[model samples]
Target: MAKEIERKFLVSGQRWRTFADEGIAIRQAYIVAQDDRSLRVRIYGNGQARITLKVGHTALVRDEYEFEIDRDEAEDMLRHAIGNVIRKVRYKVPHEGHIWEVDVYEGVHRGLVIAEVELASIHDEPELPNWVGREVTGESQYSNQSMALGISEGARLHQLA
Candidate 1:
């Protein structure tokens, strides 16, 4: 079981680049579900897919399982997704004792940027950088998966990729 607990922020400037060592460009799709506390699946890239499920929970512990799946299977599963699959630039930054993945939203979600850090344990402490904006950890709407779905849910929003 892997528990991911970290903070997310809206990118205000290029300050995050200072800590960036490397990054990978990924295409992701988030499936729509009625419950948020329980995430169904997160599809990353064109041929890679991971299904995440919340099997148990406690006051201080969050447990989840991520299984690797073929890209074609994930695409077929999410073929009916409501939103658009957007293209964005994601950069990896290192800070404290953890690595942070910062996503610079392009296309419609442009002008929007965010950073996420995955923790080995739920009790781990994370150091914050100066460029971090609003914290949106529990906000589902701010989730990258939700943002991808937002594209088709409404009119097409354009941003320079």
Candidate 2:
């Protein structure tokens, strides 16, 4: 099992785009989404796909298991997904010594841009880029699972930001 530890922040300006790579198109959905556990299927670009299972109650850390799956199967899973299928383009921006993944949401949750950096340990502090706005690390309302389930709520939060 892999421990997924990361911090999430809202993107502020367009400056980070300078350091970011050409983004990959991503479409993901949850087969099972709950407060402490979830099963998700994600398809990246037009070639790769994965199924992930995450279990934990803590906001910053989770036990995660991911496996490559057939793209056809992943698409079938998305058809049966419990909530909205999330559409986003993910860009990897290198800042300081860490790579921050910036997710620009599309479809129902348009105009939402969130940046996340994975940590090797809980104590590892990644420098925040100037383009990052408010930190939404532990906010459940900003979580992708929550956003998928509550489409209108996600749009409202983006407007408030």
Candidate 3:
């Protein structure tokens, strides 16, 4: 099985933007990953997509999976996503020796930004970006998917996913 493991964190301030090395402009991928509210399919880029299943207490997980999906197809694949946020402020930060993706959300999640680091193993520590604040990798509140649908601890967020 293809599994994506990573961490999540809440954006403290605008310090991340200044530390960002680059940003990318993206559109919807046109696929769905949500079916039973626990599983979802994500499409990204031109033809990039993945299917993810809610593993456990996502809140306590340091690693989370951000699936790519199509804008139109996202409605079915994902249920907890908030609004139509296609563009993400993606930043490349080096951690340990690996690069972390810090996405400063746009549109509804404009005020929300988080840093994520992907590793081959959960034990590997990567080089971090200068703007990288405290690690919220295991907090589900920082999950992009959760933020979209507003299903965190007590976050009464708007759900348009």
Q: Which has the greatest lDDT? A: 2
Backbone clashes under 3 angstroms, per model: 0, 0, 32
**So what's the TM-score on candidate 2?**
0.95
Give one digit per residue, the lDDT tens place, for model 1 in 21-135.
Answer: 6665555555553343444555554456776665333323456677887777776766655466656667888777767788876677666677787766677768887777666
| Model 2 C-alpha lDDT per residue in residues 1-161, reported as the tens digit of each score | 79999999889878999999999999999999888999999999968999999999987999999999999999999999998999999999999999999999998788889999999999998888999988888888788898888744754356324
Model 1: which residue pairs collide?
Answer: none
Off by over 4 Å in 3: 11-22, 26-37, 41-87, 152-161
Stretches of candidate 2 exceeding 4 Å from the true structure: 151-156, 159-161
Model 3 clash number: 32
lDDT of 3 at 120: 77
RMSD (Å) per prediction: 4.8, 1.6, 6.3
Better of 1 and 2 by TM-score: 2
- Better candidate number, 1 or 2, judged by lDDT: 2
- Give the C-alpha miss distance for residue 6 in model 3, angstroms: 1.2
Instruction: Identify the candidate with maximal TM-score.
Output: 2
